[model samples]
Target: MQLVDFFTLLFMLMGVVSAVLVAFHPNVLYAAVALVFSLLSVAGLYGVLGADFLAAVQLIIYVGGIIVVILFAIMMSENIYRARFRDAAGKFVIPTAVAALLIAGFLKLFHDAKLETRAGLNAIPTTEQMGRALVGPYALVFQYVAIVLLAGLIGAVVVARPHHGNPESEAEKK
Candidate 1:
């Protein structure tokens, strides 16, 4: 196989493994860290697919901004490290059914699709076009996303803040 193909497979494997870790890891902090690796793998896939802008955005927005905020929130919260998640055995049936259906649908779609190999598939830099679209046609959507992100950040800060007024009591509680 070619080098690019090898890298593609490696990134795909990394993404899949990290995603499993994100889902199954009991420690919330460890799961968040695994999520970072998963996001990084996705960014690598975007890079391989020649979507440089998307790769950068994935790294910047997800790994850099969102994950950092999540880690900080987890770290700042009291007793979160001692928290344990309980498995809800009864709740898995519906989600498992939906996942099975989705997997089957995807398999069928791939089986029915006609994929042809193309020569001279050059990587086109889409940064300029993407920037223009975001500023021109999708300006409102971009602004709305920014607003939502800002609100989430504020909410995280509020939720992570100590409830009690007395500093000595807060330390004792921790």
Candidate 2:
């Protein structure tokens, strides 16, 4: 009956469709585009669920920053256009089946246990409280994340190093 519920269902459906396309698409570029659409759809669902801050952050930070970086990386990498995108689904079949069984077992245990949610005692999580907890108590984790990001940047530069080998040697190898 509500507009939000309608949009939520629509967005969820769109997200699932795009995500499936992303997984099954033969071309990496198409897959990337599908993945972006999927992420945007999920962000829209977040907005429908009344988490505007999370929705905006998801769209801006993840969809904007991370996806753009990945797309750029795909473009910049060697043998991208010329290479064939291999479907690696067969590789995941056995492992995925095992994981699904494990997950089903967990769900069975969870449902059979009949755990009641304590609603009154628990307050809805607030962004302000989360920020305070992160900056105050988990400040070290913030620092660690910064270090990890820095290391990733360093690794990227090192791996993409155009100056690593002599031109003559590189030419000979090629």
Candidate 3:
């Protein structure tokens, strides 16, 4: 097998293993860490598929942004640390059966499909074109999204801030 194929297999294995850990691990913190590895492996797969922009976004948005927030929340929550998480008895059988059926169906569909294989063709990079479009035609939509995110952040801060105006609130802080 080629180097690219080897790396693809490695990344696929890493992603699958980590995803399983994320799902089944009893510890929430460990599951979150596994989720980070799973996401990073997916980003690696995107890089292997020549989707550089997607890989970067996966790394930045999922791994960097979302995972950090999740980890911070997990660390900050005292209740989460004190609680023990476990699946109820006999709960796995149905989900396992469904997952098996879905995997079988997907495998059968893939085996029956006559998909064209692009073996040696180099993928033309579209990141530059996408950047140009985002800055040019899609700029307004992008700005609106930024504004919405900013508003949400501000709202979160306002809601999370302790009330200081009430006399009872001031007394409770002491």
Candidate 4:
């Protein structure tokens, strides 16, 4: 196969490994690190697929911002790491077998499905075309998305603040 294909395969393998570690690892901190690695590899795969802007957004939003917040939250949590309280890890046999069967069934269904050909529409999508679509036609939608992000930021602050001295706690004191 071509070099790009080889890189794509390697990146996909890394993502799979990271996902397994994230899901099965016992240590929550290590799992968070694996999750970050998985997100980074996904961003790389987006770059390999020629989604330049998507890759940047993935790196910035997922790897740079969300994962950091996740890791910090994991670190700040006071009671999650006690070994005595950690539940016994469950056996994986039945759930894994079911998941494998479901995946195989989905693959079979996808193989049997056929796409219907439709009338011609313009298919070329370069950066300039994407820019025109985003700004010229979808500017309002983009602004709405920005507003949503701002609301998310405000919500994060509201949720993360220490509420120890709030009126509810004061009422409990009385």
- Cα lDDT tens digits, model 4, 38-106, are 998898887676666788889999989999999889889876566321365466668779989999999
Model 4 TM: 0.68
Candidate 1 lDDT, tens digit per residue, 1-52?
A: 8777888889999999999998778778889999999999999988887789
* Alpha carbon lDDT of each predicted model: 0.86, 0.81, 0.88, 0.80
In candidate 3, how many Å is residue 6 off? Answer: 1.1
Best by TM-score: 3
Clashing pairs in 2: none
lDDT of 2 by residue, 97-169 (tens): 9979998999999989966443222334457876897899999999999999899999999877665468975
Estimate, for each residue in 130-172, the C-alpha lDDT of model 3 and write its tens digit.
8998999999999999999999999999997769897887888
Q: How many steric clashes between backbone atoms does each model show?
A: 0, 0, 0, 0
Compared with the true structure, the alpha-carbon lDDT of candidate 2 equals 0.81
Candidate 3 regions off by >4 Å?
79-82, 87-121, 161-164, 168-174
Best by lDDT: 3
In angstroms, give how far residue 121 of model 3 lies from its true place.
6.4
- TM-score of every candidate: 0.69, 0.65, 0.72, 0.68
